[model samples]
Target: MTALPYRPCAGIMLIDRHGRAFVGQRMDSTLEAWQMPQGGIDPGEDPLAAATRELWEETGVASDMVEFIAAPDQEFFYDLPEDLIGKVWKGKWRGQRQRWFLFRFLGEDGDIDIATPHPEFRSWRWIDPAELPRLVVPFKRALYEAVLAAFRPYLNTQIGIEAVSQSDRPR
Candidate 1:
């Protein structure tokens, strides 16, 4: 029997003082949607460590500047593209089991630099939390919603007027 494949991953949701979150547009890809900075957990690396590394590698934010808020209790799954499925990584499963993190950005907006070597994102911007649902990939929307809900309490309390009256505003 073939062994089952499982890979661990980590992601960071960096929130700013204006109650906005950083979202990156994938570089060199046709799909133009945006998402949080994330990457696979290296062998023997803890989830938090991996999240910190990924945040810096992808967004140019120093690991020490952001405060960790929470980690998701569950993992998210998605299928890999068929063309590169087994060719890249030696795993039977194509997707990853991810642990997500929420962080408050302690640095200014000028600190971000997506143009570093081997850049993961082509561009990034501070976007309103309410706009995340429409900008993220559909399959990952639920997980993003859950992560946002989990970190809601720690997010900056100064919400905009529009978000206040909406009953369905993310927690």
Candidate 2:
């Protein structure tokens, strides 16, 4: 059935100093696909806050270690595959409606620790932003493409670096 509502979620696209996006291989999957930090938003919680928390919970990256870069004008949505629609998320959601936020990592790579209290990733690494769709699971490729397109102007560019650096400066 196509009537199930998508879960409201937030996603974090953290960019390292080299301007690559962070991706993680799922601990529960046998496939080679990877994904960024994302999770359902708690009731009454702001999406930005949810994104921040998800990033920390999944990657051990605190809010202050990164600078907010930019967010697209829209949210991205994707549906689960036909065979697994009822096998995930307690079979409650059709998929996710994700609000993605871009953040520039200000700390050293050592600051990142995927071995969190409750880890979801088996491994993690930074990759070129344009390759996100190819690295993600098939179901979420389109969503990743849209995210990459929306943030293309800022990713891996000197303008984006300057902008993020400027924002971190004292008034």
By TM-score, the best candidate is 2
Predicted candidate 1 versus true structure: per-residue lDDT over 12-60, tens digit per residue? 8788877688999988566878999989898888888888899988988
TM-score between candidate 2 and the true structure: 0.92
Model 2 per-residue lDDT tens digits across residues 1-171: 479999999999999888888999999899998999999899999888998999999999999998988776587999999888889988898989999888988888889899999999999998888889999999899999999888887775443343654443222
- Tell how far residue 32 is off in model 1, in angstroms: 1.8
Superposed model 2: Cα runs more than 4 Å off: 157-171
Model 2: pairs clashing at backbone N, Cα or C within 3 Å: none
**TM-score for each prediction?**
0.79, 0.92
For this target, which candidate reaches the highest lDDT against the unseen true structure?
2
**Model 1 — TM-score against the truth?**
0.79
Task: Give candidate 1 misplaced runs (Cα > 4 Å).
Answer: 1-4, 81-92, 156-171
